[model samples]
Target chain A: MPAVVVGPGVASGASPVVSVRQVGFGYDGRPVLKRVSFDVGAGDFVGVVGPNGSGKSTLIDLIDGILQPQQGEVLIAGRATREYRRRDLAREVALVPQSFALDFDLSVREVVEMGAYCRARSGEVRGDAEWTLARLGIAELIERRFTELSGGERQLVVLAQALMQRAGLLLLDEPASALDVSHQLRLFDLLRDLNADGLTVICILHDLNLALHYFSKLLVLSDGELAAFGPPEEVLTPETVEAVYGVRAYMHRHAGRTYLTYSPRLRGERKGRIHVVCGGGTGAGLMRELVDAGWEVSAGVLNALDTDEEAGRELGLRMVVEAPFSPVGDETHTENVALMRTADLVILTDVPVSLGNARNVEAVCTAAREGVRVWAAEGVLAADLAGATGALVESGVELHADTAAMLAALTARDGSQRPA
Target chain B: MIRLGRTSVWPGIVLTAGVFVVCLLMSLAFGPASLPLARIWHLVTAGPVAGDLDSAIFWQIRLPRALLACLVGAELAVAGVIMQDLFLNPLTDPYVTGVSSGAALGATLGIVLHVAQFPWMTVLALAGGFATLGIVWMAARRRGRVNIFILLLAGVTVSYLASAVVTFLMIKAGDDMHAIVYWLMGSFSGRGWTEVELALLAVPLMLIPLFRTREMDILLQGEKRALELGVEVERTKRLLLVTAGVLTAIAVSVSGIIGFVGLVVPHIVRLLVGPGHRGLLPVSLLFGAAMLNVADLMSRTLLMPNEIPVGVVTTFVGAPLFVYLLRRGKA
Candidate 1:
């Protein structure tokens, strides 16, 4: 993996565009944001992500000067935002709100022209309005009613309006929330292009993958406080994600980009340790089920590049591996038996018998003989397990049709170990 | 290459101005004693067509009353546009601040108590209008921002309260109900040079909102968006509400509660030229003036000598058009 540099800000050389100092704010005496502070440099493209009611939108509002912080200060361009006149601050910062419902109809050109209001001496700013509409590539929509445009088109026009203000910092509140996939990409591309032109952008994003893919820096807000703020690769670890969002996450790298997969965390602690013995992709599903169900899981005596091994490593499970196309060596078999010896239960997944690996069924039978509880998948007994499957069941191994039945049997036996 | 034509606003302006002038001329000529267009022109230019009746009716009565209607219509329409933009609600009108109801209450009290005459009654009505607005303003304002929902609710509450008071006074007046009803229904029946002058005085107040046209446009996007765009949202809203209240109060004092012009005229003009107030304001001024002047003419001629109050005629014409607009789902 390429090294991701972690720092105070992305554009470290450039002066900060927005500097929030221990800002605390709330509505109707109930605090929504508490002592949140972060610095956004002049050319930074930062994405703010959090679960619902996490103050992502409140942070944007404070930075945009729509709401004053009850405690601390927000400074734009080295001046306190509260001290700057509204028009002066407007020339420094512009916000493209999520969506606006216009009560009266205004043409796209007219709407965009409003961005130049603070600069214009009168209502007319013909040159600036025309230039902005053309620049945003929506010159064709200049005469169309704003209410009649598609969601993406309307968002683009609103972005055009904000750009026309010529503000140094642009704040967007979930700009892509209502857009289709294609429109979402189009909006991000537009923002990227604008950022390339030296505009600093801070956007609140609900989609974590988009934030990881697009932003140089991520600000993770959880329940109105800053959980983490750093480079995406540094801040978006599985542990941090699970801690802040309460979901189990797995980060994967493909095509030189990182993707995060998430699932609801099981709401309890581990009941006992379990060893899963299988190969040829049969063990992958059982390993995931065991891990999510709060069992300390280990899987092994398999070829190095097996799909199960990959899943084990992704879910951070302990495993023993041997080289592919080779027989299970004595060293690997010994390691698998030692793992089974410590486990409270051993599970054998249905795997077809092969010359390279028939010892997996033997390992389960050996563990059952040693008084370790052994559970065999229903189909394993019918499979041609080199004649070891019959011995495995004859050794007093339990049989389960599926993962659900296995989990139910384990839960019943480990009732005393279950979390309250 | 796509060519940009000059705005398309000028053509609408020209068309509105033409309609206004034609309506004014027709209103001046048609009345209880209908005069020929040529004769009316002569009366204005050549002074009375061999009779004092034509001269008296032309200069002193019809012309002032017609001009007063034009001015009141323009003021009310401009006020409506400002209120609609400030609230960002199409249903909002000039009287949303309870100005008309307050004026009605004052006019009713004056009739029942006999405490004031025409000019004094106008003063009392203006006082009542501002006082009621002040209460609604206080009730709705919080942390220096006017909560639009609260403002609307307070306006409705105060309007109901004022109407209840007016109803109580109307019951006390008993036999004087006809006189109070005529005033309440709103009319330009006896308006003269003074009423026209009063409306002219209020006409300049339209410039307050006109100067803030850009702010109003930004406000139409929604208050929070406007504030983010660097507009002093609270200040702009307060200025617009006060200006609209003052204009509506003045119009109501002179012509009673002339309904619909303040509510419907701006909407019609908006449909015609779009909602950019730079164009909408001026065009609405013309269209509003024309509509009221024509309605006043209808009031005099449709029932002849019986003189249906101009307010009744405006409602008769405006309500159907408003309903049509509602059915069309365009307003």
Candidate 2:
């Protein structure tokens, strides 16, 4: 199915199979893989992470000898990698790469079988295969066509093939990227088992939480350079997270364990707002401010149940309520007039004062004439109400634009906190 | 990750042997000889003893031609397999990089000017191929290292130039057109001990060194993975390329640019056996030999009075099979 399937079972109890020393590689004279060097112990499981385009994949290729370093040499089992015979190298080292489609339609099993091609005639190919698939939890997927499988299933199958080689050293490129949460954790668990069983593994990851949880060694890559390399706790500091993510953050200790969280600053400047004569239902917004500013509020000249009337009810404001369903009918006008006379301030809403409600408008004028303060909406409706009432020419009655100005007028001293 | 599965390595082995026997019988029956089957068998068995014209014709003429077919087929097919894996391209063969064209131009130069007496025609052809590959490689390289796309481009450009040069040389050779064209077309006609002896001398020598690389599994998958496990990537690649190129050059130098066997034979055998360099290399070699042998037999018999070139016979037969394979989703 693969143009040819070589079946060589991975050698057992082999010595360290690969090594790199002071390696520096670049492209077009710009360094993509710098003079970064590290050793993968016989069964080492190293996890790599970085920002986008941070050269993690390239490091894997370089470590495996796909690309040679300009400045350093690569060795396997104490011998120069260049010197290990081909069959010998294959027997000792195996790679399980990220899954890719071929120009040909080989089955999952067929594709996996190609890994054994070098050791085609050697014994235990089936056993190795069964073990590998079982370890990856994809034993039943062997018969499924590779193209038809889900991304997670395909990843496991590919990993199974790489593991079937039973090589001492495995180079994996994001082996669990497409898997679900449990599957990703399971994949790491299997990788841990393989490492424990003495197969050196190198994997790349992006999630700091998972990387911290699963891997013992964390190689932090930034801009194709090694930012830090050590244990997760040693390398993953609050300062490091801030440096990489380019934000202000803190390492918080909760319940005796440390975690990273951010204190977000304003993203952009605030746009200011002011409200005009918002009586009746209009001044619900003003009630919101009184609540936000920790202030008390009261409004009058409503028959009952106006828009501002309901807001005042919700806010538990002290309100002068008129009679229901009727405006300036006898007793309600007397009550409103008495209330306006006692109030220190009166605001004219856009409510029209016809013959039936002429007395209500007179209360506002009377209040203004008595030097009680008054404010009006800036538009024609509020102007008409103010003119009908004969409030000040410009002295006693003030006109404001939108809600922000109206609220500011109510709570002018309180301006420190607002959304950006 | 390509997993190695249980393979029917024996089927390919059996089929290869079967093809050899059937081809030998087919060959004895062909070539204007009106002998009975029993008589043909008797005639072949009755000799190891030679001297008479009939025996000489059978042993020296036909026997060597058949053997040459086998060797050339093996050489080209194996060479194709190696080249394909090296390039990571299914469509590529040994001559995808114009190794054959370069060899053809060199051979044409050799025959036209009678330079065969000096540096040796096979040697000249090999040099021409390696030199052109070098030039193309250098041209493909820009600033420093060679990329895969650049190499492929260089191969296509060099192939075109080499074809043009060969055509010019053929025109300049004048009245010697018959010999030149026939040879260019390619055939095992009139080939006897010298051709077999020459192929035996060159092609097998290259295969011996290549066979030592039993770890070709590592080489074929990818060089880096192999190196991480302790394979010297550059050295292995160099050795493989040189060995494969030399075998291909020898086959071309002797057989006169047999096309597609290197491409088609490997693909067919790979579909049958798999990509293990061990099985792939050997199966491709044997299967290619059988394919060419059959094609050679057809060339001689199909147009008996006007012999067809073995190259023509092969392309004619191989191209359709190749198409069929692609359609079958086995390409």
The best candidate by lDDT is 1
Q: Give one digit per residue, the lDDT tens place, for model 1 in A299-324.
A: 88878778888888887888899997
lDDT of 2 at B303: 79
Task: Evaluate model 2: give its TM-score.
Answer: 0.67
The candidate 1 chain A region of ten consecutive residues with least summed lDDT is A1-10
lDDT of each: 0.84, 0.66
Candidate 2 lDDT, A341-417, residue by residue in tens = 65545555555545545565566656666776666555524435434545444346665565566566765444544
Q: Which ten residues in a row have the lowest lDDT in candidate 1 chain B?
A: B1-10
- Alpha-carbon shift of residue A208 in model 1 (angstroms): 2.0
**Runs in model 1 with CA error above 4 Å?**
A1-5, A10-13, A121-137, A266-268, A323-325, A341-345, A369-373, A381-385, A399-420, B1-6, B46-51, B325-331
Which candidate tops DockQ? 1
* DockQ for candidate 2: 0.27
Candidate 1 residue A145 Cα shift, in angstroms, is 2.3
lDDT of 2 at A24: 71
Alpha-carbon TM-score of each model against the true structure: 0.92, 0.67
Scored against the true structure, residue B281 in model 1 reaches a CA lDDT of: 84
